[model samples]
Target: MSSFQNDTAHFAGLTEKQTATARLLAEGFTAKEIAARLTISESAATKRIEALRQKFGGITKNELARLAREEFSGSPSSHTVKVFEKNRDFSRAPDGEKLTWKNFDLPNTDGFRNSMPRNRPETELNFSDGFTLDATPPWRARREERLVPEVLDGEHAAPARWAYVVGAAIGMAILLLVLLAVADALGNLA
Candidate 1:
């Protein structure tokens, strides 16, 4: 048998929807795009793709697309196959002339090779004597290095403590309202 017939025969067991999903996948359509094309939910499209994967003996999506492409290439379909032109000129001009360093318009390379002989101005700083200071600042000092006064250690509360309480109260109120609304809805259903 021909390769096209052999490839198509492999997917003969797939349902119409499964075949369509595979064809869309081979055409580079995402699950969301496939869902839109087939008028199905995105999750449904994903499930169909997963089913195709399982049906093909746990092959990857790319492999499935390859198989689908081989299967559909012989069949006449409305989906247009896109052809991309490759860039074959490896840094050469269109007329086949090789590019030179002068094409970049770079600076002179004469003195740049031996930069060790270049002289630079020295940097200096002057500080007065007896400028001793602690290595760690007071704020960042370790707890053992710093001692807190008894008056300052009385009580410490979080800044947003009231916000949490208010949020809880509002959430409870909303929950109670939803419960009441649901109860009323259920009562009217009788």
Candidate 2:
């Protein structure tokens, strides 16, 4: 809202190339050299410098140089410090991490047992051939086991039920004979 807010806010709106030019200009680079360093046309670089001057209220080259070191020149708030702080941390990581592969973690195969590319001194891998199998078997099994007993299926349950009833009858007859013998001995003693 105020006329003299921080200028770094506008710097945020500038393209990456503009930011690079500001940085180079601050570092004592000429327009031509800045263009060569960035692989851009000199005129384009010059235009960017002119644009930088306009953004800082028509500042001359010296004033532009001054503004390059300034924290905020374009709008109000200075974000350059924050941006550089972030970039300083980001550059230490691998390029794959900085780019589209930020989620990729470096491989740490410390506990992996089945690591590939086995380095055998004698055997070599055949590319076209399939992988080699590494299985072994004993000559014969030591223990002998009989087949499982045949289960009485639903249809055969009727015949099995009669056998169970016969077994129950035999058990009851033996029990009754014992009880009768005990009663006869008691009767004789009376």
Candidate 3:
């Protein structure tokens, strides 16, 4: 087993950004090395590492480094995945087929808030309109699988509650009763 595997407590509370710094650091990276890996400024890496240490309440740089190596694999964590999934707005295509990424949100990112991020994976899953049907790898198989569920999920979004139907029926009955009362009043006046 890796020496790092047993030291999980030292790496607790490392955020996504810190995990990145830690992975580079574990490979004997300098602050500049960490920055280069993430395409950020050296001071950005340094300050981020500092902030990470503070968040974890580490008393020394070594302690911070220890935590980062323990927790930071330089990729999104399970919790991060959950956050992103929760933020994404899923829908069937307007035609109720074709699982599309045409205008799909990226879950929790600010990019998703303003607009959908591009599906720019190295395999070139994009179509002519900058959309991708590649939810999983090997696009054709996944695309076809999406068709039935897309239609059904969209159809299911329409209200299926008994309460809504009952409420509508009650509302219609009340409106008819009001009309009948008005007609009776007019007849007495005539």
Q: Deviation in angstroms for 129 in model 1?
A: 36
- Clashing pairs for model 2 are 6-75, 6-76, 7-72, 7-73, 7-74, 7-75, 8-72, 8-73, 10-75
What TM-score would candidate 1 get against the native? Answer: 0.37
User: lDDT of model 2 at residue 93?
Assistant: 52
| Full candidate order by lDDT, most accurate first | 1, 2, 3
Clashes of each: 0, 9, 2
lDDT-superior candidate, 1 or 3: 1
What would the per-residue lDDT of candidate 3 be over residues 101-154, giving only the tens digit for each residue?
Answer: 255445666646676546556676744866667356664454344544443356
Candidate of highest TM-score: 1
| lDDT (Cα, tens digit) per residue for candidate 2, span 1-190 | 1133445666667788888998888777888999999999999999999998777666456545655655434422233222112233444755422322134577778746576646755456445646765554577544556442334335676777777779899999999999999999999998
Q: Which stretches of candidate 1 lie over 4 Å from their true place?
A: 1-6, 75-190
Candidate 1 residue lDDT tens string, 121-163:
5544455778778577867747574364443344543435555
Q: What ordering of candidates by TM-score runs from best to worst?
A: 1, 2, 3
> Weakest 10 consecutive residues, lDDT, candidate 3?
77-86
TM-score of each: 0.37, 0.35, 0.30
